[model samples]
Target: MNEAIMEKVSADPFAKLLGIQIIEIEEGKAIVSLNIKENMLNFHGAVNGGVIFSLADVAFAIASNSYGQTAVGIHVTINYMKAGMFKDTLTATAEEVSKNPKLGLYRMTIRNQDGELLATADGMVYRKKEQFA
Candidate 1:
């Protein structure tokens, strides 16, 4: 793991606000975790889909930008496989599938502590010339 990249991603305010923790990061991969909270639940009592998507998005963002380049999400699609309850620990792992100078593709999976699949997402990012230090 590069300390510079880790430090940059660690400073994200939205991730901080959601209590998302970055467990690991590599050139094209990242793992992040979050513990479900009461406020994150939807009216039906399950963890909100937006929260799950945000957790996965954070992983995707970190991995895509791990090279120190500025990367912005261009397209994303997610499928919810199961419901998450309060206190459930969710982890989202994102891996780079392919990339070029200007574009990158990634796949992310969200799972519960019990190792059950909660959601899967596919994302695309537009790699920019600017860099992150």
Candidate 2:
């Protein structure tokens, strides 16, 4: 499903225009990254919060689907610990904190290339039964 999701997301003309990429997927975790460019900067010349949030969300989407089942986010709360700088390849990793038969909890950290913590995110996702189940 990761490959399928990536294809669907990348097939979008707008995302293609923005050059977004889904980098890697691992066990109960995902690594997503994008370089901060001029268009992504806010008024103060820092990376926009929406961009950071989207990256974190992408990581969550991949990690929550880690167990070979579908999952959908029920809640997501993000704390902006620090401002993200421009021109850096912002990376976010989402790790599953806990899970049950019907629920999953995840925490994600957004960091700059040098490993400075930019934002912290937590989300609660509900696991869905597989279509083939």
- Against the reference, the lDDT scores of all candidates come to 0.97, 0.81
> Per-residue alpha-carbon lDDT of model 1 for 25-70, expressed as tens digits?
9899999999999999999999999999999999999999999999
Clashes of each: 0, 0
Residue pair clashes in candidate 1 = none
Mark the regions of model 1 whose C-alpha exceeds 4 Å error after superposition.
none
Highest lDDT, which number?
A: 1
Query: Candidate 2, residues 15-98: lDDT per residue as tens digits?
Result: 355555667766578887888888898999888998888888888877887656778899999999888876898889999999
Question: What TM-score against the true fold does each predicted structure earn?
Answer: 0.98, 0.84
State residue 80's C-alpha deviation in candidate 2, in Å.
0.8
Candidate 2 lDDT: 0.81
